[model samples]
Target: MSYINPVLPGTNPDPSVCRVGSTFYLATSSFEYFPGVPLYRSDDLVSWEQIGHCFNRESQLDLSDTDTSGGIYAPTLRYHDGTFYLVTTDVGGQGNVLLTAADPAGEWSEPTQLDVPGFDPDLFFDGDTAYLSYAHGPTLAETTIKQATVNPDTGDVGEPSELWRGIEGTFAEAPHLYRVDGTYYLLTAEGGTHLNHMVVAARSDDPTGPFEACPTNPILSHRGHPMQSIKATGHGDLVDAPDGTWWLVFLGIRQQGGHPGWHQLGRETFLAPVEWVDGWPVVNGGELITPRMTVDSLPGDGSAPDRAAPARATLATFDDETLDVAFEHRRNPDESAYSLTEPPGSLTLRGRTESLGDSGATFVGRRQAHFDCRIDTRFTFDPAEGAEAGLALVADERHHYEIGVTRIDGTTVAIVRLRIGDATETVVETPVDGPEHSVRVDATAEEYRLSYLQGDKDYPEAVGTASSKYLSTEVTGNFTGVYIGPYATTGEDATSPASFDYFTYEPTADE
Candidate 1:
């Protein structure tokens, strides 16, 4: 059977996996997005479904004003005894917090804020004793991996002990401790989270060890291999399948357009086979990851595709009381700012003082999973004097493109604007006589085209276009993928509301 590289695609990065009985559960980072820490479950590993978010309730998580790529760092999902534990760092919120649930898909308890003073927290349970491993450093260049014994029931932590500081490269973080065959093995991702990322390992006979680095340090890395499609490969977790097979689930990016390190889909979850050679773990036979891999099939599972394909053609209608799992907000959104049932079949978003460039914007979006795709939405708004409401494609606070309708000089107008670095420019502006309109943004490998439809017009007219490269990670120097969705701002009281009819995303046929 052949499976895809990104078992879970899009912005699903910093993956951590664990097995409970025959089912496998995975968690990934949801930086600056509400309902943080997206969880997925799979019986066959090849075909996965989003189970639920760990931080679903407002009380469970608070990411208010967290900068882009600042909230919900690397998360480690592990099942101990009969309970599921998810430990992670909330960068700009409550520091380190631990969550637990009886069922992986059920509601998780409110976070237990730990005293740990670092990021990328992992929980390893050996019998009744539990250990917490994390990365501590003032900056990425001086980071160090540390560990401490902890009580799972209480948030108390023991004295921190220094562990391996990585054999090569800086930012040696995302540490996972495991006991294999009567020996302790510590795995870490170093060389930063950029093109030079790599995974290295060290082993000892004790949990807190006088560890020895593997002679073949950096056992897995795609660095220096520009021709390879997968780059910046690291931050992996290992799990043993029910069939007694070892698999490595890690984060990697798929570049396009002959670009060596340019990626718009963000870091995605990738899977590869793992084997033990001379008591050391070797991944993918020490080879660069490919887009597809052939593997053994699960015994009775046949829903998996012959090959993994990119996500395409999705429609999100606000028909239910709750938003879909794919929909995400900038940060901790105001509880009173959005509603799905108020208008019945429409998503009503109330404008606020926050703008797209602010930390707490009333914006909802999903990852731009595909490079070549079209995103369109129908919205109706009668804005106040200074209110603005419409759609946006965002890379970060400083880099984004927006198509919005605002009241300018007592007239409702549709405008397309672009923000790059410290400069902001309006690409197109048109008067909208009516209160309702449909806007669309089509993205190619090179540029993005903004268009709209008014009244009963059968075709959308082009409003403006902008270069796509300016909104890329290479240009912005940010660690997030692009998100497309609706937004609203009133510059003050923010009492005006915008009603969205529906949102649709369609990828090009060749994507």
Candidate 2:
């Protein structure tokens, strides 16, 4: 059966997976977004559903003031006995942390800060002995795959020992250790997470390896293939199925536009079949991955009972008892900034004095999973003098394109604003009469079209456009993708709040 490359799409990078019984569980890097380390469960490897986040409470994760792409790094999910352990690095916070849960879908315990000094921590248990391996050093070029004996229950780690520095590559990170039969295979991603990203392997008889590099060192990569649609293919974890088949789940970015084009959806989770050949695992018959591929060894009847449709869409009315798991806040958001019960059926966002250009901004958004998509929202915001509220396509604080309503020069106006780097501009503005307004943003691989409804008219008037490439990681130099949702900001002494009636997101057919 053929399955999509990104089984879990949109901003899900540095994937780590573990299998227990007939089910597979996966986790990925969240990076500066609240409720960090998204978790997923799958019956079939191709179809996954979000169970919950590993760090759902503010007490578990404090992303406040963390730099862009600096909060959560690579997470390794492993299951031992009946307990599940999740270990990861908070690049700009409390360093490495360990958390466990009896149920992956239930609330996880608060973090236990590991005394390790590295990123991408992986936990491996051989019977009762626990081992922790990670890419350690002060910088990428100096990184070495290191392992140490660990007490999983108390988070006490013993002295570390050096493992392999990657073969013919730099930035050795994202290490996962597995004992296949009697050999300990160490898999690590090297050459950074860009065009040169790659997955390399080594093997040793001991967990603290004086190991031998695989003859085919880079078992998986798309390093030199700039023209391929799938880019930055690395950071992989191996999972063994109950059918005795092996698979590798990795992170890759899907490029749009032209050669070495821009990717605005961030790094997504991709899968490939693995076969053991002469004691070493070969990924997808030693070939790079693509968006569509056939996995003959996939489990189940090629059907996912609860899997989302190919073209995913969502319509949220903010009438639910709590926000959907799909929605996330920027940093540790002011909980008081948002309300679903204030005005009964509407989602109210109290404007913060903080602008979208800073952390703690009053913004809640979902990852932009599709290149060709449309977002339509109806909102009412009586801006206090210089306040503004509306929909936004956000890459980061400094890079975003927004269309909303604001009061400028005492006139209530609908405006389209573009913020790239240090330059911010209101590209289009038109006077509107009422507080209630409907806005729309249509996104393609190349650009975003901004429009708004005029009065009681059925059609929307065009309000300029912004280059999607400018919002890409290639230009923004961030580790995240585009997020589209509602936002609001207030000036001093502002009293009014922006209340959103409904939000609709649809992946449209390409033009």
Candidate 3:
């Protein structure tokens, strides 16, 4: 009956949950990655599976020019009357979009943009009336939670009224509205998304409330426990178990190293039991969250895939036409820039004018879920004058490490490039006699090492090593985790296609 924390790991942040019958569905933010909003299904709350994505097609969402961490933010998933509704903000693109699907695992309907002003949008259904609650801020220092009545079908919204301005935290966001025992409750995350994050609530008899703050505000937070592994606890969603038990799924980060936390895997989903005390919700019995716990009332057979394991290992041959759910591109990828069938069994990526630092670049990758893992890829590229293609360990546009193949002096060579903040340096450059050669990136807890395969041997030649600390959230000051994947870029009109024969990622046992 024991379950580990991070029910969903590695950048799966801003989790929202809803129940349909005995089944539960959870959705998380995808940021700038295309096929956005990863959805999961769990029969017993302990075992979860990726069912589908909410924004799987361009018609459903267009993140073409959105910046990293700017696409989809804080999606609120709710099931109502045989229809599943997803409401969220696009941050830099479309403001707020409402989408619906009959089945949570199937195709969602076209989005209906809402006229709401801010982010972290939530929807609550009561009879024929639907209510929308979202965050509104004049400045980050001063923010307010607001709500309004809305037509579910037409996206028409009534006038919004202030619900709560937050008790003490600066940024009050991620609002979820729930009615328990005929009393409307408003829960929100505050203290921003950093180490001081917390979940607080207010309740009233009316949906649009003159709400009273929970006397014991910040029902859940790790700010007081600096030594605790789980930090930044907030942005919670409540759900009722089949047996009438209540559970809360919230976002939290595991900080490694010393205090004044540093986290790299980004915000992840964590589960906690909830109890109703005097008509108010208390999370994890109003205590600091533990990394592992036993849920006696809920069944835990441990059949679910281990979230700590690398998403994929051995090989990703790109033989199938569809990209795996684990693979994601930066922003909306240019369809013409990538192909699976052109060369058959290999992923062909055409170089573009955009660099890895720019939006809409030709890059696709998976999360670096494990701190100690080996990621390698074999590719053949005949670059045009100024084109490059290779493997990248990306923290952000400005902070990443790349070992790529590019043409230099009429010869193709494997080069290791480092981009930390405003500095960019080429640390290694070795001539590749053939077009097909395997490049490997190995990451330990301390550093990331780059190498190349020689004569059928794995990583026979060493390139160099870079400190992993540079790719952490503490150094980048970004809200995303690192992604290890392939990238291709060109200058101006130059176009070069790089075909990846295969890619592999295996986590070390000790890590």
Residue-by-residue lDDT tens digits, candidate 3, 1-511: 5567777767888999999878899999988888899898887665677877999888877887777668899999998888999999998888998999998888999899999899899999987899999998888667788889999899999999988899884699999999988999989999988888988989998888888999999889888788898888999999998788899999998777776656777788888888999988988777788867665566333454432312435468899987767788877778898899979999989878888877767889987766678999988877866789999988889988998888887887778899999999998887777677678898876788988664664443448789887888888887788888989998853377889988888877443
RMSD of 3: 2.4
Against the true structure, candidate 1 reaches a TM-score of 0.94
Give the clashing residue pairs of candidate 1, or none: none
**Candidate 2 lDDT over residue span 445-510, tens digit each:** 889999878566643444779889999999899999999999999886335799999988888873
- Model 3 regions more than 4 Å off: 299-315, 457-461, 492-494
Who wins the TM-score comparison? 2
Top candidate by lDDT: 2
Quote each prediction's TM-score: 0.94, 0.96, 0.94
Q: Judged by TM-score relative to the true structure, which candidate is superior, 2 or 3?
A: 2
Q: 174-266 in candidate 1: lDDT tens per residue?
A: 999998889999999999897889888889999998889988878889888888888989998988887777888899888766854467778
Winner of 2 and 3 under lDDT: 2
